[model samples]
Target: MIQLWTPEITTLLTRFFKANHLPYGQDFPGHIPTGRFSNGKLNPDFVASFLGIKQTVPTSLDPNLSNDAFNGLVFASAGSGYDELTTILTGAIPVPKQLGQFKSYIAKLSRIFGNNEAQNIIEKSLAIISAGTNDFGFNYYLLPMRIQQFDINGFQDFLLKALHDFVKELYKRGCRKIVIAGLPPMGCVPILVRKDSSRPSIEHVWRTRMLMPVLQWKARFTETEEGCCGSGLLEASFLCNPETPVCETPSDFMFWDKLSSKRAAYKAMSHLLVNQILPKLTLE
Candidate 1:
């Protein structure tokens, strides 16, 4: 019943607040929030509202909450992922570390409520995860560590396996409802698009092609300008060009930045969460 990345819900939050603000941080005054990247609301805030729960307690906030107050919280960090490398790669908090924080959350909840109640809360609550683009960008493209250890396919498999294990740990600890996000077309981020504008304007090359989903969501953008084809190359070129002029309507595009996806990309993620992961939670 929890909705995380729905634009419809986000729009509502914007209207209700009567302020054009995103939950994520902005650099400009009155623009950037402390940590969030968006102008007003991030996916988690919107999702918490949609679930009718107050926004979940951030992991960092876990140390300060009363036990009773902790039971209803949802734990989600924007720039985190399953692999330690993703955060180290992105220079953001990694997934395993976040799980460590979750341990504290569980402990806090147990204190306010009895062990049974804490377990019950976690069992029913949903955990949503979205990460991995940074690993490719910050680690692979930027260095030789993971890339030296594994090829593109190998790296992809490694991260997914990491996810499998992370979710399994959550499940073992009482987290039953969980959602995992597949990679979107990251090649079109305004920054990467800009990067591609340099000397290497290659089509469907490993640099860009590797970023698209390997197995899931394969056919969706396969033919579009963002897909692995001649036109896709041209699109990346135009979009990446510093002189190409950035579009205000980022939702119309796929990639938001070199490391994140736009609204459309998140929309695809929402579908997988609802249609695929949600139904499977009870199966756990």
Candidate 2:
């Protein structure tokens, strides 16, 4: 299974008020390390549990963690993105580096399981990708401020190209089933709402401006932001301020935070996968 370029660990750690921010540390290994971007489990772990697979494999650091965990492996970093430039924010392992790690893992599997078994392993794998939010949230919206270079469309195009390339690489690596998630509404994230609000606006301009672009792009992907449990702009506000009153039901919302989705969002994503993408892939 693939769980690439997500901060599931980091978000959970921050939820407990930990300030150290372990997920972004560059020294953290990519494949089977114990120091996953958080204090506890990551989204992959939960996903593994749901699949009835062994808990997600670590980044290649923990000697105890084995390659046989999920009948494959996971090569995700807390804040990495599909693009190289986007990985700079958290100093996490970029997708290229993770691909290299996958190569090494494949080599070891080949040595132990023989060529046919290894090939079978590679062919039947499911790749789960959750990225792009960092590209907008940290790179375009936060850091140098991409609004200066291009409008939302240009930036979305750039991100989609990166994703396209990443998917192509996976196809080269013998993966046919690809599950890619679109960006959640990031504007209402507490980080953006609180930060952008400091700027001038008419009617929650900070939130509306930040979210609309992402929402537009959501329609481009098979799994849309609409009716997602935890990923909409409205939902993000509620999640970031759990104590505050904004939206009553989070199931229809899209964003879980600035960078992720609620359980419902994943369900929507999965529905698209099982119903739309999987059939096409099977035909391929």
Candidate 3:
């Protein structure tokens, strides 16, 4: 979370400037905006639905949330990444602070369910961790803040180490069923593409080569190049605010904005990964 007298993220939540929660959810099934970066549900929400735990996985920071977190909840920050600097620059929650929030969530659980049951709940729950894209896109590729210290390869290594450490911390805290989503095609994103970044990182090698049935694209979507948002070249976040014109049919597009995929794309990925992850998380 952003450091202050008290932690706050004024841009999306916490005081008033909610940039992402207006007409942004125009394509959502419920037609309700919930501050997510996309037009509708995220992959984690679809994952929860696939697992039959809940139709929607609530965020941990929901203002009206109660003590019962048994079905699980999201603890993600939209613009955050593996690097603390990346998070700091965007006023998003950092990795360590996210863990701290999890610790607090556990303590609350302990008070309600008792220590043993709380620990048991954590162990039985499934955790989905998604990050790293912003580390390369925001820090290295966009700003060159970390480029002064590390090349793209070195930055990738540093992020991988940070991710390992985060996962280890989660394991220590009793998370047994954990799934990590790797980087998306960031170089092909409208924002990065407009930035003139065409060269893909080494991760692209595996992303293009690996023959994983789970992640294999079915090619259901036709619009792979431009986002549905205005101009489909540079609009993202605040730039993709209300009053901006969007395409009539977003489901045909792979991306909703400059950075994120459309809800349809996430739903597709959710279906694929759920089959792969469900067996592992459910079996013993």
Candidate 3 structure quality by residue, lDDT tens digits, 111-214: 98899998988887777777887777667876767899998788889999998998899889888877787776566666656565455556445433442342
Top-down TM-score ranking: 3, 1, 2
Give Cα-based local distance difference scores for all models: 0.49, 0.53, 0.68
Worst 10 residues of 3 by lDDT: 1-10
Model 2, 171-199: lDDT tens digits are 88777766776665565554465556665
Better of 1 and 3 by lDDT: 3
In candidate 3, which residue ranges exceed 4 Å CA deviation? 1-19, 197-219
Best by TM-score: 3
In candidate 2, which residue ranges exceed 4 Å CA deviation? Answer: 2-5, 9-40, 70-72, 145-149, 196-284
TM-score of 2: 0.61
Candidate 2 Cα RMSD after full superposition onto the native fold (Å) = 8.9
Q: Write the per-residue lDDT of candidate 1 for residues 1-284, one digit (tens) a residue.
A: 22212111111121211112332223224554333333234455545544455543233433464543443443444444555665453344466866776787678678878899879877777766666766676576777688789999998899889978877888888876767666655655545554555645565365456545521452243322232211233222123223333445443444433333343444454444446555655732
CA displacement after TM-score superposition, residue 84 of candidate 2 (Å): 1.6
| lDDT for 98 (candidate 2) | 76
TM-score of each: 0.62, 0.61, 0.84
